[model samples]
Target: MFSYNSALMKHKKIHKGEKEFICLQCGKRYRRRIDLAYHVRIHTGEKPFKCLVCGKTFCFKSSLTSHERLHRREKPFGCLECGKNFSQNIHLACHMRIHTGEKPFKCLECGNRFGQSRTLANHMKIHTGEKPFRCLQCGKSFRQTANLSSHMRIHTGEKPFKCLQCGKSFRQRGHLASHVRTHTGEKPFSCLECGKSFSRGSNLARHMQSHRGEKPFKCSHCGKSFCERSKLRTRQQIHPG
Candidate 1:
């Protein structure tokens, strides 16, 4: 037999699916009045919690605690799979999906899935044809802000990713990772049919096309089929000459 405290009894409402406190602004329900008060601050834009180290303000105390970890260079959460440390537990949880290859978030517009909700949100913009991020230099728009950032790097000629093996640097991390594979001789992507391996997935895809003799791309003007886009372009050049 166990005795229930009145304070503990109040929290039991959450498990019972009782959300008594409702927000006046968004009509979002909360189990407790204190939780509702915190939610109300979001609409009011009231950041009561302030970081002493960086003077950064957060709406919630938990957010302030997370921000403090960045200033302190403290990573409380560690991924058991890869031994990677993260400042927040949510980040570690997201990182685990990379090892597990678990893509939980799926797009309703298309059957395409993503490891994270943010990636799914970015993918949805492709179907909607919404380009929120615009480059001021060329007036070019992108569906994702990250793509715009990468485009800006091309204009700026900023190569942030540097290789440890050689002094070679790349504008993108993906490019750097591929370049590093040249030094390591790591060919992770392999063909299941021939057991042939390639450094890049694109190369493996092209290799598979050779095995199948699949001429997918056809020249629009000549109607001549080619195994690759470059081959089709080459055929067009011959016609023009």
Candidate 2:
């Protein structure tokens, strides 16, 4: 029960499924007037809230508070399963799915499930082939904004991802993760056919083809085929470019 009369009235609206405030621009309805005000910022492209640490703008003050924690390297929320820390409670919730292997979001198109909604959204673009984010320098497009941001590094030569082992740098985070496996001798990927392990997933995939007798790479010269591209390259030399 609500303590105040005003709060009790607001609680009744929740039960009645009533949304008094509605946005004129998008026709989206909100329970409270303040929520509708926040929704309007999306159409107007207005982000008044700014982070002092990184100078990043946000639409809401609550978002600014969450962004500030990143600058201080403060992870108040901790995962109970693995004891992993996260800056926000939402991130900790997402991490818990790893331990339980829970996939709540399912793609209607492919029937593939994902632990996170963002991943499901990213996967949806693969079917549509809609590349909205484009690189200004090379005119190359990417389905996700993160991919476009990573593609921009090719022209800018920005190697932000660094390794502690050899002080080596890479343009992408995945490259850094693979490089880290080298120092630890961690072969996470394995072949089911032979139980053979490989440091990289690409290596494991190529190894799997040997068991299936699949030669994906083919030569146009004499109609010869090989499982590995390197062998195809060697065979292509006889034909000449």
Candidate 3:
């Protein structure tokens, strides 16, 4: 219950499901006139809220406040478990799932679960077979814009990820990470069954098949399975007529 009648009357409108203010542009309704004014600014391109320090303007006062946090380097929201800080409270709440292992987003198509909503959205595109991002150079298509950007680096010979130790360069960050393991001899991926370690997760996956006696990778030419993709690729090269 609100102490003020004005505040109680505003709360009563929510219970009554009243959206008196309507936007003429989109026909979207809002309970308050101030909310309608905020929505109208999207179409009007009116940003009255300006940062005094940077002169960067925002459509809303709250957005301007969030933007100002970047200049101040203020991260008030801190994670209790990990001690990681975030400028926004929502980001810190999302980071809590790393320790919790909470897959909040689920796919209706394949029943796959993801920690992030954006990751679930990307996975949904796989079911629709939608590759919106396309490369102009080779006419190659990718599900993500990041993949298209990496594919473009092939034509341009752009290796942004560079190794400081060997001065070696790689187009992809994952490739550079694997290359760095060669110098450091860091075997991170370890098998729970055998305790055998691998530099890459793919290598560990292939190693796991040996323990399981499962040969999933079948030769397209022959009906025989090689237990690993690299071994199957090698066998496919030699065609036995």
| Candidate number of the best lDDT | 2
Deviation (Å) of 152 in candidate 1: 1.2
Q: Mind giving the per-residue lDDT tens digits that candidate 1 earns over 29-73?
A: 988888898889889999999999879899999999988999899
Candidate 3: regions farther than 4 A off: 1-8, 11-19, 22-29, 42-47, 50-57, 71-76, 211-241
| lDDT digits (tens) for residues 1-241 of candidate 2 | 7799999999899999999999999899999998999999999999999988779999989899989999999999998777889998899989999999999999999999999999999999999998999888879999989888988889999999999999999999999999999999999998888899999999999988989999999998989999999999999999866
Q: Please report, in order, the local distance difference test score of every candidate based on alpha carbons.
A: 0.90, 0.93, 0.92
TM-score of each: 0.80, 0.74, 0.73
Q: Count the backbone clashes (under 3 Å) in each candidate.
A: 0, 0, 0
Candidate 3 per-residue C-alpha lDDT over 1-241 given as tens digits, one digit per residue, 9 for 90 to 100: 6899999998999999999999999999999999999999999999999999989999999888878888999998999897989888778878888889999999998899988898898899999999999999889899998899999999999999999999999999999999999999999999999899999999998899899999999987877898888888899889776
Between prediction 2 and prediction 3, which has the larger lDDT? Answer: 2
What residue pairs clash in candidate 3, if any at all? none
Which residue runs of candidate 1 sit more than 4 Å off their true CA positions? Answer: 1-18, 99-102, 216-241
lDDT of 1 at 191: 99
TM-score, cand. 3 vs. native? 0.73
